[model samples]
Target: MEVSYKEEVSVGALVILGLVAFTLGMFWLTGRSIVSKGIGVDVVFKDVSGLKEGDPVRVSGVTKGRVARVHLDKVGKVIVTIQVSSDVRPHADASAAVASADFLGAKYVAYNPGAKDEPLAQGTPIPGVAEEQFADIASRAASNASQLIENVNRGLNPGQLAADLHNTLVVTQRGMKALSEASNGPMVQQTTQTLKTVQNVMARIDSVLGTRDAAASGRRLDTLTANLGQLSAHLAAATKSLNELLTTMNKGEGTLGRMATDTMLYKNLNATLAALSSLLTDLKERPGRYLTVKVF
Candidate 1:
């Protein structure tokens, strides 16, 4: 009986200790102050973005308080009550903002202690600003993607591009077929034959001029040039001789020069001609007497 009593007492004591530890752990996890010396500050926001009670209240990235409760005001705004430690002396203009704490929707209230020497009074309402939420960012990104897709649909019509390409290919094929037909026509064939004949004639002329008759033509040209040189030399010597003869005549050294330059010889020749003319006149009148004496 004594042993059974001791065991029962030990089990009851263990049960009470376990209950005490469980309660203390629950209080700590829920952010309930074991000592209630903290001051309460009211924070109002348009949106909390999943901030709830027991979330940490941070000042300059350090936790100095916790959100005590969250509710809505009369004008339909979110009001979060923050319990700040008495040691933290935030100014009267201290403000609050909600921010994401993790990948989950867990959030916290960020405090900004304004630059003032005076501390904020208890129950003073601190203004809270709504921070951008991941959900809002994702929604905006989705909306922009939708708008981009719509713009792509409006700007680029693949069917039109394909139709234009097909038309261009058809025109190119027609042009190629026309070219082929032109190349095989009769006029084209005649032109090709004529060009071939002209090419062959030009080749033969080139061969003759380059090899077969080149030496003979060069020899004939040399002989003609020599004959022209001899003719030029003979003409120059004849011109010199004629020039000498003209010089002697002009100097009164020959018969023609004396006749041209002597005045006395010219007067004597004139008198002799006059005498002969008078003798001829006398003979013509007495021609019968002269003729009878001559006959005896």
Candidate 2:
């Protein structure tokens, strides 16, 4: 069929539109922006964990751009070049990591803006962390479990354990049997008899001490206690009297107090005693003078 000019023009226009749409779709599918090259960021990781070019680049869990290139440096570190959206500017303190996008092992570059107040520097390299794959973790865990099982097998012998347990039980049973026999022996019986005899003697002693005698003894004790209490009171009174007498003497209030405290009175007493001694001596020397006996 010969196409009309208008139809031809329409087909051309449709083809052009389809091409443009396909280009845009591919860019979108590859997680790239059709606008500018966007901001470039270099991220270095120990290993990318399957991260590759065309992988989505996320900023704070949001898809922002796509990884443009991935290569290993001379130092064997994987460097990822990402072109993010114009608005995806991150500070110098930002962090980048290889993140798992799906269970099928699809990977992405996950970034954190980190401290929004920090200054953003262009083309600065961000340190990246390699994501731990679930399979690796599972493999390590399985290895550890295997090692533990092997160690248990090497250390533990079931036959030896069973034999040890049986020996222990047998020894314990024998000891218990010997103990039971000893508990029922002649010495045990003698001890029981001795205890019973002592109990009987104590009972007999209690019985021999009559209730009347006990009561009488308790009454006598009470009377003696009362007499002792009276004696104590009398002694206390005597002590008080003696203390008062001493206090009176110290104060020079009674005659003895004056004699004890007055120096002049003491001197006078001493002089009188000396004079009496002199008179007695003179009288002794002349017995007739002192002994004028009226024998008439």
Candidate 3:
């Protein structure tokens, strides 16, 4: 049976619509399966750098899940919610980082499970981490390469440096040879003679010190010690005597001290001298007055 063009077009359109609906249903079912079987967790990154929804999530280089959504929070943080398999327990201390999968800038989420204890929970927000960007790493490497080139430019050639060291060694060797030639023979003989003279003098001293008369010298030293002891005792006795004499003088007890310190003795001595002088003058002027007993 021949159909109308309008009817045929309507049938074709319905088939296409059915295929589209079936594809949509399959996609919806897949999404629900992923959500139910996988655990969902939120991650915040400082810079996602080409990350998008449906990117694969990896744990230790193995693909575990995919990113569900990428959105900017109220605070302008790039929050990436990821769905991971429930069979794999991610640690609470696990970190989520954005990483490149290939050279074509295919980005993915990397989960580093730190320890077995304290597993991560669903709907928890992982803190944003500072990731090393490719541009920054390249810039630092360029700077380091430039500095290395500058260092290489400033370096000296190895051949020239070795030649300079060789020249220094040659000069040092020549100087040592000249010094040895100048000091080799006569100076060495003179030094040897001087050492021999010193040895001879030491030998003479040892011989003299080792003689039998050295024993007599020791005996003389003992005698000298005894004499010193006697002298010290005499000195001590003299000091005692001198102290007694000083005590007697201080008390005005001795005749010499009285003569030195007594005022009455001084006056009597002066009067006696005057009387003797007067008698001497009288005898000198009238000799018969003192010599009259000589006549018969």
Candidate 4:
């Protein structure tokens, strides 16, 4: 019996489907995953403490997936990539820790999905807290402290420290002595005399300007300025009066102005004087002619 080409194709497709279903069923029963068809989350740890690939990754103690890879990052930190189920989403406050799977020393990643109402913390590396050996660190710290104390004890020199303090005190005493001598020196005296001379000169200048006692009264400068202003006002009034007199003389208006500038007034005065002189001469000459007849 020969099979048709269509039947062969159908059989092949069926076989593929059966294999996929069987694979899925097996994964479901054994709680194991072959390929990651879910989310890949990167977690960072300073130390993994023997955690390696294929270790189970748990979500709050429930196993969700397995570790995908383990490697050192650029900064010397251990980066553990875990493939978790699609439904296992971590919130912003989610954290991971390298936990002990059993007493046999098997390690796994313990993930905690924080508050559901919080924002989803997908992408970026989640920092994992590695179990640091506190006892080892404390022991090393004690040893270092003891060594440091020993080093300090060996390096200390009591005599040298006392000598240094004595030297500092001696230097301070010398500095104080020098400062005292400088204050009493001739240079300081000369500076004081120069300052006194400057004060005397300023006093003399104040006396000369008539301002030495001006504060008791008013400022000499201000008084002088006021006197000058009054003088200027008087001079301005005199100038205005002189200008008015000159203007009146030019217009032949006042008594002196008419005498100086009115030609018609001058002519009238001269004519009146001549008439008086002629009448006086006529009276003197006619008095004898009239007196002879009267005496007979």
Candidate 5:
């Protein structure tokens, strides 16, 4: 009876162990291995989107690791811890990125090895690049479009829009009417006549400057310019001679120059003129007395 009871207990214990092993096997098959041991590398991402724990981490498309944990940091970025295998050596400058596994939105981490010979130290926080998932993007775009449509429906008023359009048309109509009235006024006619006159004057000027007359006028202009140049040269020579004559006169070299510069000569000439004037006055006033004595 004791041997049978021990055999029953051993069988029961074996059955329980089998069940536990099956459960572990099932979890391991589903990529939730309890015995997974590797170095944990923290990676930060702005958005992980569809990435989750137990997602396979790949190096050059080969599965070498798995994501251990995913959480948000203090600054709201998605912090994902990747558990890399002990055999694989990822560089320090290696980068981590998220990728879609299939069209069903399963995501995984993609590792890019850096060119460094040294491997990344354990527990190092690597930078993560958030690749945009097509599904997520399409979903967000659809959601945003739906939200925009709802906002438009809530905020837009058809009646107010129509009224604003009507007011704008009214303002435009009044402006057009004012412009039409100004265009039809006498000022417009006067401006038109002035413009016509200016056009006629311009036509006349064009006729005067026709090709044949232009050549003839050009020759005449050349002759006039030549004559002006000669005149200018002659004027310059005359001015130089006049300057020399003025310099000679200033030096009292000529009779006119001496008379102009000599103060004593001027005083003597004034005295002689005064004496002649006085004798002329006396002869005019006493002409009868002098003539009578000569006649007797």
Candidate 6:
């Protein structure tokens, strides 16, 4: 009976140990515990606030990893090292920001996995994101509220405000009365007459534009049409002559074509031009000896 009791106690102890081991294994597999098996990244924060070891690291509100360690560097800044799962690549653009989980000052590192092309390596430092503290926001709100209250106090003058409002109401009432008067009787009749005058002027202009005499008001248009027709015929003849000239030039038939294509014609033309220039110079110096002018 003593041996059976001892055996039962031993079995109970073994079962408890197995349960504990199973729980630990499950935690490790689910990445709940701080294990040094995965990729590590470092982040520097201005203030750790209430962040601690084994705190979950979230990416866009989803838990991806945990904070492995938090320590102060030589410069006295809080340097936090986080271990994330190897499956997720935290790129270089990934930022670390402190976020509160509850009112109990429980803070965690939140990450933004930005720009997929640049995957962060082991021991890489993530850039810190600017976090607005609740205290600072509350202080700013209080200051703004105080300023608004001061502005209201400065602007609130009951007597002057009442007088201004009364004056504005009186002016508005008078303006409404004037507008009502203008919309009725003789004023409306005058507006109608003006509109009718405008309509009549527009009708007259339309009639003038539609009239045959108005269409033929200027003789310059007829003259221009005749001149354009003659110019067009002359241009057509000139174009035909130009085409024939181009054809003759292409066949090297004219003097200009020979001058363009033949080197001998170019030399002869050059000599002739030089000789003509010299004869003109001599005739200008001694005009009567070069030629006698006879009027018959």
Report every candidate's CA lDDT.
0.74, 0.76, 0.71, 0.73, 0.75, 0.71
Candidate 6, residues 111-178, lDDT tens digits: the string is 77677796777577877653677788899999999999989877997788998898677545544543
Q: In model 1, what is the error at residue 55, expressed in angstroms?
A: 1.1
lDDT of 2 by residue, 1-296 (tens): 89899999999999999999999998888766666577888888888988877898888788888899899885659888888777767786888999898899999889876777775676678888998988999999999999999899878978888888986775455445444545754445555655565565455445545556877767656655565565556556556665775687668776656655565775797799999999999988999986777866
Residue-level lDDT of model 1, residues 207-227, one tens digit each, is 546755768757655655565
- TM-score of predicted structure 1: 0.53
* Per-residue accuracy of model 3 over 1-296 as CA lDDT, tens digit each: 89999999999999999998888787575443333457778888777888888788888899888888889775558898888887655678878888888878888888765586987775678875645778889999999999998787668667778988986775455444433654544434545555565565556555555668967757655655565565556556556655765566456676534544565765697799999999999989999876866546
State candidate 5's TM-score: 0.42
Clashing pairs in 4: none
RMSD of each: 39.3, 32.7, 32.0, 37.8, 29.8, 31.4
TM-score, cand. 3: 0.44
Pick by TM-score: which candidate is best? Answer: 2
Model 6 regions more than 4 Å off: 1-35, 74-76, 157-296
lDDT of 4 at 231: 52
- RMSD of candidate 6 to the true fold? 31.4
TM-score of each prediction: 0.53, 0.56, 0.44, 0.35, 0.42, 0.44
Model 4, 122-214: lDDT tens digits are 577777898755556789999999999988877887778888898677545544544454575444555565556556555644664764565
Ten-residue stretch with the least lDDT total in model 5: 170-179
Error of 4 at 42 (Å): 0.9
Q: Which pairs clash in the backbone of model 5?
A: none
